[model samples]
Target: MHRSTRDIRLAEALVETADTLVDGFEAVHYLPRVADHCVRLLAARAAGFMLIDEDGTVSLTASGTHREVALDLLRAQRGGGPCLDSYSSGRPVPPVSIGAARAAARWPEFTERALAHDIAGTFAVPLRRHERLLGALNVFVATLPPETASPDDAASDDGTELRLAQLIADCAALGLQNHTAYVQCRTLAGQLQQALSSRVRIEQAKGMLAERWNTPADHAFVALRQYARRHQLPLDRVAQAVIDRVADDAELRRGARGGDDGGRA
Candidate 1:
């Protein structure tokens, strides 16, 4: 791709990443797009995302392609790779030759799997929101460009790519955080609504009981409370039963009388 065209595409990709912060952001769908962006816009042959779930288990969340998915799953199952290391350390892992002795020693299983897939080198950047680490983005390099053939030159170029990857990962982390907050807020709102509905039902039940027993609303409420306590039922549930006429009026009256007698004693 021409440099100007690639720059335009890069900007578009960043915009798409930022768009995920809006409503209806699905991580399963968004993550694969992130992986695809890395491969298309960066020096990555393939890309994948690994995330640490609530149980602290690291797993392959998404990948740019099936082959990359398999490679990421292997890393997750066997438990040591650039992605895992980056996520655990909350830092970037610079490009490392997959065939290097140190790579083999540090991640023997991962190195073997990566080599079998014809990947030459790999790097990782942690996904973070402020100081909190969410996951890591892995990029597989099939070969180095001629301009970065020397170790020093390769390191310098890798540094630039690493920063770009971190930028993408930062956007992903923000999207994830926003989605979490949205879900939590929705849950809280639902709970409040349910509480309000339950309160309305309880008040209705109180009025019905007062009319039926020819007693004050407060005394009727005491009867409902005593009945619920004796039956080991939720107060809302009992109130709902009263509203539904499922509870026997005579039985409740007897129970209320028993409570009054006990209080007098």
Candidate 2:
């Protein structure tokens, strides 16, 4: 890709990441788009994203293609690949020659699997926000000559590609954090709305019971609460029942009489 064209695509990818912060953002869809952008912008054969769970298990979240997905799955299962290393260290893992004897020594199973898939080299950058590590992005190189397959290979020796990859990862991490906060805020707002609605229903029920029993609203509320406790039902449910005229009138009146006596005492 030309330098100018690649720059335009990079800007577009960053914008896409930011766009996901809005409502209705789906991680399942967004992650694959990010992985595809990585592969294209970095001129890599394949790319994938892996996320670490709260329980410390790393899993493949998305990939540029089915082949990359399989490789990512193998690496995650083996738990000793570049992506895992980057996530664990909270730093980028430089390009590693997958077929190297040293790589075999370091990550025997993963290296063997990657070589079998015709992957010559692998690079990884952590998806992190400062001290908080979320996951890692893996880049696969399919064809690197033996002479240039070292970690200091010309492909990324200048560090331009690595820096670009890290910038993309950082944008993704920030977008994910924003999405999580937006979801939490929406959930909290829903809970507050429900609570307010429930309070309104309860007040309406109290007024109805007070008029029916010819008693004060406070006494009627005591009766309603006692009925709910006796029936082992939620206060909200009982309130709704009173509003719907499904509550037992006789039982409520009995509770009202008891409340009256208590008030007198």
Best by TM-score: 2
Could you tell me the TM-score of candidate 2?
0.82
TM-score of each: 0.77, 0.82
Of candidate 2, the 10-residue stretch with the lowest lDDT total is 256-265
Q: In angstroms, how far off is 53's CA in candidate 2?
A: 1.8
Compared with the true structure, what per-residue lDDT tens digits does model 2 show for residues 1-265?
4456666888899999877657778887788889888877776677888888778875675554655544554464354778778988999988877767344487877776676777777788999977899999888767756674444333445288889889999999998988998899999999999999888888899899999888988888888778887989887788899999998899877677553444310
Q: Which regions of candidate 2 are displaced past 4 Å? A: 1-3, 22-26, 66-79, 99-104, 144-158, 259-265
Backbone clash total for model 1 is 0
Quote the positional error of residue 183 for candidate 1 in Å. Answer: 1.7
Instruction: List clashing residue pairs in candidate 1.
Output: none
Candidate 1: list runs displaced more than 4 Å: 1-4, 15-26, 66-79, 99-106, 144-156, 257-265
lDDT of 1 by residue, 165-265 (tens): 88888988887887788888888999999999988888899899989888877777777777887789988888899999999776566566443533310
**Residue 26 of candidate 2: its Cα lDDT?**
86
